[model samples]
Target: MTFQPLEQALHEAIDWMLRLEHLPASDPAHLAFEHWHAHCAENRLAWQRVNGVLDSALANLQGLPGQAQVASRALRALANPPRRQLLGKGLALLLLGAGSVSVLNRLAPVADLLADARTATGERKTLQLADGSRLSLNARSAADIRFDTQQRRVVLRAGDLQVQVEPDLARPLIVATAHGEVRALGTRFMVRQESERCLVSVQQHSVLLSTADGSARRVEAGQAFAFDRRGSMAVAPSMRTRDDWVHGRIEARDEPLGELVEALRPYYGGLLRISPQAAQVRVFGTFLVDDIERTLASLGETLPIRVDTLGFWLTRIDVK
Candidate 1:
């Protein structure tokens, strides 16, 4: 009913659009966005505005020289309650061309570019640390390493990693994520930073897992745990087979179509999308991460799904 809430929702919708553009359709963020979009009339209207702006400007965005600057100014103006007028102008300038969106997208991963260690999509790496430890990074992953006299710490910025910690009584090895820190006690483990939480799976020995709230728990070998900033809140049977991805293979045992798409996203160089109906399908197999097209073709052969390609950057799956 109030213009203020509509304006707020508009801003939030734009932010969510930026994030969801790259996230898997099955991510909790996507579900949360669906909830917000359906919350009320104002929210839906705000989302409509976002889509309308993009639809109106995407095709005519060629050679808009000063559009990026104009968009930036208009976006700043929208922050001060200049809702309708400024928002309209900002979206117009921002979506006017693919170039503007390209600029913004580049700026999105600035931190990863400056990270100590990073792997691009479909790329993997094995690093031998100075402390006789081994660190393997998965696709689309970034990490920052900091070693000192007191502690050996790794800050995971995005994606997943496997760490094999060598014995070191002098310094405690810790892997830190947004949710918490996992202190490895001479163990081999895996850590994945998801949108809503961090998942830690121990392969050998135990680790002292602590959340931002100071709550701690022991995750033993053959155990997997998920936690948020509040603390270690969940435990599941460790899936050692998951580590196969480090070797360029994806092992999906009756995984949902949406989840398989999520796992394949980092390996493929495109916007891979699955329709809601097709996402409900179940997939089981080991696919090669490096050969996304072959894997998709194989999936199409066995499942009742259609794989459509739009250039080299967009792939969509829907019920046949």
Candidate 2:
């Protein structure tokens, strides 16, 4: 219950922050500040996370030379978000004055109630939901969840996921990604929606994939497909094995090294680059996701591939 409230506050705060940060320190925002502050103290605290995110965002922008002038000029992004302070006051009332931590808990689920969360840069997570279902997240994944009176929705503002869903008429979990939207109807399936292409592969049960333009496709279990601005296509049957990555494993059945690299990009941080000539190399079989060093080592030994490490984290794969 406590968890639910915190998450609700978090979701609300994030939306407000986006609105505030996108705007300048204008008159209407300033005039609205007082009521906003009166709203709650938790709002103020919640905004801190946005500020924290901004600090890092600014630091990154600062390093980009010409970007310094443009971003510094936009430092006001933080100033106007003072609107968040309103949420902080209300939160304080609920947590402190009301002294009903139990009341709030019973009333709301606290933060981090979502079934899954994954970090960026060499991170992964496997989550088991309340319904005896499973969801796995790749690197840099995020979702704001709402399992309300009717449907369960996972709003994928970013990231990729594979879900094993159990039957539940009360609530069916749906994942919305950038390129397309997918909903599981009591099934085990994989959904990979990057900025451009969205891939859906059903291992068992079934799924429905729909694009922004309302192009709909029913993906049955065992078959895999990918879609983009060009439109969706049934991924070659040879590339349909979707269960291989469950235990940090990648399986390629006579797949081009180029295609393999593209598939692996989201799993790795920085870059997983392949040269034009190197992309021509074909790779086969499964590799352990747990052991990047050993996996790359095995590739070097088994295939005409060279693993060139310029610096600690920089690795380039080339045809030997």
Candidate 3:
């Protein structure tokens, strides 16, 4: 079975689960759900798969911190029409045994959905701004565009973006993140928001990288920089591979397996778990971002690791 069909079935099953959660047994929706479930074998399988995990998880919910709050928030979000789809995706991942409630909470794409521009998992998008600048978002990325007479800014809410400035001297183009801001001095550059730090790679001219603190640094063409809220510093120029995602590829040169897995997660639809020992293994290669299974197979062939997949929703990499 293809992953897409199963994924769609799971999503539909989740939608039905939410709708029927508070409804009475005689609710009209129950009959409709029964019809839908009987419509195909995949639907029956998906319903069973979801309920199997949900039943087990719910049995232990009391022992799990914040599970109740997470469930409440998910239900509340589902009640909001505009947020239903995004919340459904998050909830499906949660009930499918992806992670802890806290982890799933953080993985929820609420902020991404509210951004001016965003891309779904395994999807990429490019936008032509009002200022004639070009902004390209990597998979699962989100950014808000703000334009004014004084300045033009893109607030990157998540993931990575490559921006090509139109060069309006009247208003500088700045890309902001939790760590700091990248003021485009030249033409093009890329900024990635990581958990603890922000990464900037200049492809055209230069960018003025400023941290949340007062410090600033000039990142010239072909250079890369990384910073946290507290400080900033230059990184290896080889960090240019950071933009490889723009082309649906990951170019890893002696990169840690964990970092590579992190890059792959946004492109993969399911939860990808890696053991610490497997994560520390060094990798060097170019892999397609979209063909996750093929990439994993290649890694398994070349690296000392075991890749195990559970249906279409979970994959684990462990040291062999």
Q: Which stretches of candidate 2 lie over 4 Å from their true place?
A: 1-116, 228-231, 237-241, 266-271
Q: Tell me each candidate's TM-score.
A: 0.66, 0.60, 0.71
For model 2, state the Cα shift of residue 167 in Å: 1.7
Off by over 4 Å in 1: 1-108, 235-241
- Per-residue lDDT value at 53 in model 1: 66
**Candidate 3 per-residue C-alpha lDDT over 1-320 given as tens digits, one digit per residue, 9 for 90 to 100:** 77678778998997787678779998899999999999988899889876665444444445656554454453354333323444455556665556644334333343455568877656677889998999999877889998988879999999899998898888899999999999998579999988889899988999999987899999888888889989988788543336888888988899899989988887665668999999999999898976677898899999999999876556899999
Question: Residue 310 lDDT in model 3?
Answer: 72
Deviation in Å, model 3, residue 256 alpha carbon: 1.6
| Candidate 1 per-residue lDDT over residues 123-146, each given as its tens digit | 678898879899999876889999
Point to the candidate with the largest TM-score: 3
Task: For model 2, give the 10-residue run with minimal summed lDDT.
Answer: 103-112
Q: Each prediction's Cα lDDT score?
A: 0.72, 0.59, 0.77
- Worst 10-residue lDDT window for candidate 3 reads 74-83
Better of 1 and 3 by TM-score: 3
RMSD of each: 15.5, 17.4, 7.5
**Residue 302 accuracy (lDDT) in model 2:** 89
